[model samples]
Target: MTPELTRDCQTVADRLRATGHRLVLAESCTCGLLAASIAAVPGVSQHFCGSAVTYREQTKVQWLEVDPDLLSRHSAVSAPVTDQMARAVMRRTDEATVSLAVTGHLGPDAPAELDGRVYLAVCVRSGGPGASRDGRDDPYVVHAHALRLHEQLRVQRQIESAREAWQFLVRVALADI
Candidate 1:
């Protein structure tokens, strides 16, 4: 991992710990990269609950409990699936205060949809007064370069985007909490 990414993950982990929150991740296209980044930080176990690398459609359904009908209707890349992934991970861990989900196509060739078109969903459990009687849901996307490039460059850019995503999640989580 790059120093910047490591630092970002550490920053988010520290903030969540300070806020008395626990974190979890559900990942697809980015595989375990996001989880790995978070766990790399020292003392991550203090606030990092767990993560699921639900890379396959079946895994998303079986492990994350994503709705089969929703997956069949919109495919896993759609917003509903992303939201489900986030919520399911939160439920599965049963310890996370905040959960983050990421899904997308990282391709050497363009996808039917744009490559590097990533969807991120953050779900926060409701607590305290004025917290949503329900939970909270926020979804957004980050677009990164999609072209075929040197393997090193490709990995580098993905790490960069992952760092940015961590930062984005930090801002969102703070606001939500």
Candidate 2:
């Protein structure tokens, strides 16, 4: 992770700790980089839950309970998919109060349409319409980011996306959303 990303993750960690909330990560293309960055923060053990490095679609389905039809309709790297992935990971563990999900194609060799595209989702256990006391609808805070695929190496894109994810986390966590 880049130094900026590390600092952002630390900010997120500190903010989460201040609110007494722990985080769970569901990562796809960037793998565990986001989780590792948060773990690097001091006192993170109190605010970090765990992560699922679900690179394969099947793993997302099997472990995170992502709907296969949803993946088929939106592909694995979309905001809708990442939103569902975040909700799944957040609910899967009782320990976390917030969840962050990331999926993207950072590529020199990605599928034609997916290259350089990334989707992110952040879910707070108690803040949304879906997370109501009755456990009804579950809306997530979702976003998408992209860069020119040919403008950077795959590793560089991954690093950039990781940083973006950290920044997103900081925004939501600080707002207590």
Candidate 3:
């Protein structure tokens, strides 16, 4: 991991620990690097749930049970698909209070339309309507964002996207009421 990404994970780990929230990671393009970085944080085992590296569409369907039609329509690296992944992982894990799902195309040989596009989502289970005061719905709300980066080497772009994914999750986890 890059120094910035390591620092980002450390910050995320600290904030999640402070909030007494467990985190689940569903990784697509970044493989498992983001999860590994967070796991490197000391005391992470307390708040860190396991991760699913659903690198392939088949794995995403098999592991997270994402709808094949959804993937076919929006592709795997899309807001709708990633949001589904985040919510699905959160639903599957009793240990996790929130989940982060990431999917993207980092280039090298990606489809023309998907090149350099990354999607990230964060989901929380607060239980009850109007529980969240941060302008989001209660229970199973997936806040998703898409970013387009300069086309770079696949690994290099994946690293950058992973950093953003971690930072975004931390921000949501630390949001004020």
Which candidate tops lDDT? 3
TM-score of 2: 0.86
Best by TM-score: 3
**Every candidate's lDDT:** 0.72, 0.79, 0.85
lDDT per residue for candidate 2 within 63-152, as digits (tens), equals 999999999998998887898888899888777778889999887778878878888888877653223455557534444443333446
Model 1, 1-177: lDDT tens digits are 878888888789778877877888888877788988888888889888878999999999999889999989988877788888888887776667788887766665746564556677877777711244344353222222223222334466467557656876788774444
Ranking by lDDT: 3, 2, 1
Clash pairs for candidate 2? 130-137, 130-138
Summarize candidate 3's per-residue lDDT along 41-144 as a digit string, tens digits. Answer: 89899888899999999999999999999999999989999998998898788778889999998868888888999999998877422243353544676678
Q: What is the TM-score of each predicted model, taking all chains together?
A: 0.80, 0.86, 0.90
Runs off by more than 4 Å, candidate 2: 127-134, 137-151
At residue 166, what lDDT does model 2 achieve? Answer: 79
